[model samples]
Target: MAEDAIVVDESLGSETLLDLRSLSVTYQTDQGPVPAVRGVDLTVRRGEVVGVAGESGCGKSTLASTVLRLQPATATVTGEVLVSGADVITMRWGELRALRWAGASIVFQGALHALNPVQSVGAQIGEPIRIHEPGIEDSEVTARISELLQQVGLSPSRAAMYPHQLSGGQRQRVMIAMALACRPALIVADEPTTALDVMVQAQVLGVLEKLVKDLDVGMMIISHDLSVLASSCDRIVVMYAGRVVEEGPAHAVFDRALHPYTAALSAAFPRVGDPAARFAPAGLAGDPPDPTSRPPGCSFAPRCPLAIEACREAEPELREIEPGRWAACIRVGEP
Candidate 1:
């Protein structure tokens, strides 16, 4: 599929920004090698919000960590991750550190723990600017921090408060503000609304939506909330057991999914503007195969509703089924 697509709605702008090719991350445990993120390729474009949606243990966060190279010591990462035409996986440590803030940044999960309780939010946000461009004066750094706080919808006055002083949504905005301090070209948000109250989730997601529109920054939003992904992202990549099962335009993927896993996830959500029509969320029976001992064929075959003889004997590669849609299911496009 093309990196750039024509904007269906004239109101939103579109362009290509970051791309990942065959990105895979594995870890060596006593049992054996466990693949956390297996052969997943994703893209986020300028002025576009891309959603990576999957259930818990679906490797959504692992994929995000691999994108940022935030892994444990025993982890082995292999694949191409390109940001602004530069391969992240191959960069030297010095190069990687230099690329972090200006090229891309991350709003990781567990913000309460990510932020230091001792320091103020303003100092945390100013750290990047100060470290990266030491020549910039203190006044400029302070002004930039305030602007970032305002951009993420946090009150400028709240910058002086420590993380413990703010609510969940406010803390999340602080994380986002810190990620945006250096005006990054891309942002990776992993479960940005995981533990927030329902009311707070709506408000935080609104701020994220506005960030994409106003800052023109490419975003990779990792979440299991289909409703949020459907509303916030331009495209969706559905991950299953460490692999991408389906990917396409957000609405099209949700409405007309190809893979059985994608279909099950779609069936689990309530459609917008159709609250009166209720249906049980289609649950995929059984569990995803143990990553330590995945099956010979498709990893999802054990739990798939439509598993067949071939599905149990041969793995399928992700391939484009249409001009812009890709799926890893053998049954897709078959009569």
Candidate 2:
């Protein structure tokens, strides 16, 4: 329900809900301008779940924040972030505010920290409804809160509890409930399963997967764990040093990763029943380049096991290899 001026592009054809066209974000620090996200293009179609996987400080979080123009003033953002075809960067303040909960919503990680310790869970969930729908009766707000709670696998009775009173998984479910309160078309979940046990993580992901299918909404789940994305997402995009190194169908990328970074990440997490992987988990050595002083060639060349002199000459462009599969490495097909 953004302003009238913010209209959906007919070219998007109603399927693509969120699109990032060559998006980049740079933060101005005392040290210098640090490029957090660089020339990344991504999309999320209706009823599809897309996952963005990368290590800490690899710009996954920054990319999520930029979806709604949530980046700080010190950060310089470029390129288009089109949610339903409206550019978030160009929207007016009023339009942006209206677009937030109704058009798109975010489920931030660390539910304990994101929620209000003082407010009841119901109050927190109802707050967005009240702000977005002031004319709605208080009784109706309460009813909507209960429905959202039920949808996320939590009892309606749990609404009265505070954040501190709920378990970690319960708190995370509450966060999901809040994100669903407005029934937005798009949901950006930033590390939704972080800090939870494996069992709890599975529960949370199940909830998310079910909701996305039932509601027919597009979701982008960001995380450092490739396994989580592999299990939940339709497509997986692997990022390294502020750029996407490889992207493809979830199973293809997880089972046979083209990029060394993606392969290393996938191997880092052991499979439940795979004997060979159970005994020895792969470890990726070396650190990412400093943002302020990134090398001219491939940023990952220094740490790449298969790096050649050609890889150090210039940065490789992301190109389609086979059908929908894409990789930025010059030596993608090389054995």
TM-score, per-candidate, Cα-based = 0.92, 0.95
Q: Write the per-residue lDDT of candidate 1 for residues 13-61, one digit (tens) a residue.
A: 4445678898888889998899888888887878778899998888898
Task: List residue ranges in candidate 1 displaced over 4 A.
Answer: 1-5, 8-16, 275-279
Give lDDT tens digits, candidate 2, residues 221-317: 9999999998898889999989999998888899899988899999999987899998999989988888899988999999999899999999999
Give the number of the best model, judged by TM-score: 2
lDDT of 1 at 235: 86
Determine which window of 10 residues in candidate 1 has minimal summed lDDT.
Answer: 1-10
Point to the candidate with the largest lDDT.
2
